[model samples]
Target: MASCIFCKIVKGEIPSFKLFESDKTLAFLDVQPLSRGHALVIPKHHGEKLTDIPDEYLTELLPVAKKLAIATGAVEYNILQNNGKGAHQEIGHVHVHMIPKPRPEQGLGIRWPTQPTEMDKLKELHEELAAKMQE
Candidate 1:
């Protein structure tokens, strides 16, 4: 984590427009923002992805993001977290983006492609996942 930008920010080696900080989490304004109040919330513990971080480190992430959303006065927003390069995660640390959508043309724009569902296949997949969850 010596080269991780978020870790640098957490350690105060890199300067950031920090908004909130606690024992386990840090929230800051995104240097390159998509909207007026775009911010990033990160856990103090270094982790490249959600599964890599301990559950206790992750507990404050969403609560802080929620606080950022309220502080931004954004009624409509998107809370986003990406895991890897293929998922567009530029940083090698887990971070959540709180993007405020004040208008139709702003914030995170996504195209969710919908596919027609095959009920039997869907049911079988659901059961498979449910069985795994029990383990």
Candidate 2:
């Protein structure tokens, strides 16, 4: 973790364009930004991936991300968290990329294969997931 750039940022050993910080997380402007307001949200504690974060800390991450997006004047935003090498996770630290989507021509453009799901299939999938939820 000593070599991890995000950890260094959290520790203040390295400088970042810090936007927000709480007991559990820190938000800063991304050095290699996808857009003008692109920011990275990271847990104060070092974690290798999303699942590595404790549940308590994880709960605070998104609301902070939302607040940051609004503070940065992001008309819309994408919260991205890559988990492993196959998922294009370049950094070892668990950080969320909050990319401001101002216009179609701006920010990271993502391409994905689109498939249509039948209404019945969508309903079934929703029901199945809902049933599995503890709450």
Error of 1 at 99 (Å): 0.2
**Which candidate has the top score in TM-score?**
1
* Clashing residue pairs found in predicted model 1: none
User: What RMSD, rounded to one decimal, does every model reach?
Assistant: 0.8, 2.6
**Residues 23-127, candidate 2, lDDT per residue (tens digit)?**
888989998888888888888888888888888778777888898888888878799989988988999988888899888987878889899989999999999
lDDT of each: 0.97, 0.87
Top candidate on lDDT is 1
- The regions of model 2 sitting more than 4 angstroms off are 115-135
Candidate 1 regions exceeding 4 Å error are none
Models 1 onward score TM values of 0.97, 0.82
